[model samples]
Target: MSMAKDKELVLSHISLEVRKLIKMYAAVNECTQVEMLERIVLEWNAQQSRTERPPGDEDE
Candidate 1:
């Protein structure tokens, strides 16, 4: 599968339970496993952005 150049291909080992969950989520969402994984990562990034503060933004 082709992805944008900004993205990097990841090859990591996951637990069987995690793999099954991803498969189920992909099937329910009608998306490929890769898309589901991307959705998960994007959601995590958004969540972190909401709670994290940048340098110099803190009150003295």
Candidate 2:
């Protein structure tokens, strides 16, 4: 496994309700909670890339 995959990131100070929601989503989707979060982040990044590109910023 890569070092990045082995390292942990903490979502500190999040509410109990939010944590429960993540757990429930992971359970229903048959993925680990971290996987669910990673999927969400990946989707968010994709969407941001689509709408966030500058119109005249292409490189030659």
Candidate 3:
């Protein structure tokens, strides 16, 4: 297939995977998909921010 077709296929697969993940998390956590996604994004952002800091920067 052409490069455009390949990109579309990859995006489609990613979309499906995201939907499945949302459904699974919502069912397991007893929360709406949006709530679960919000929590996940917040945690991810916190982790990323922490990683960007220097080693001795964390307070006890």
Candidate 4:
């Protein structure tokens, strides 16, 4: 699927409960919702990259 379509599919699958949780966490952490989401996405991407890297790769 195209990137835009994938993004839409992902967004559509998110439940209201999860959305509320994200908002609550953002509020409790004193950060904007978008900032919190960006941090989460970055962290997840980093983790995926690390896992996909070679075992001997220390640069990760």
Model 2 segments more than 4 A misplaced: 1-8, 55-60
TM-score for predicted model 2 compared with the true structure: 0.63
Number of the top candidate by TM-score? 3
* Per-model TM against the reference: 0.67, 0.63, 0.70, 0.68
Candidates ranked, most accurate by TM-score first: 3, 4, 1, 2
Q: Estimate the lDDT of model 4.
A: 0.69
Clash pairs, candidate 1, are: none
What lDDT does candidate 4 reach at residue 39? 68
lDDT tens digits by residue: candidate 2, 1-60: 122353244333446787688779899999877776666668888888878889987557
Q: Backbone clashes in each candidate structure, one number apiece?
A: 0, 0, 0, 0
TM-score of 4: 0.68
- C-alpha RMSD of each candidate structure in angstroms: 5.5, 4.4, 8.8, 4.7
For candidate 3, lDDT tens digit of each residue in 1-60? 123335445435547779689769889999866566667767888899989999889878
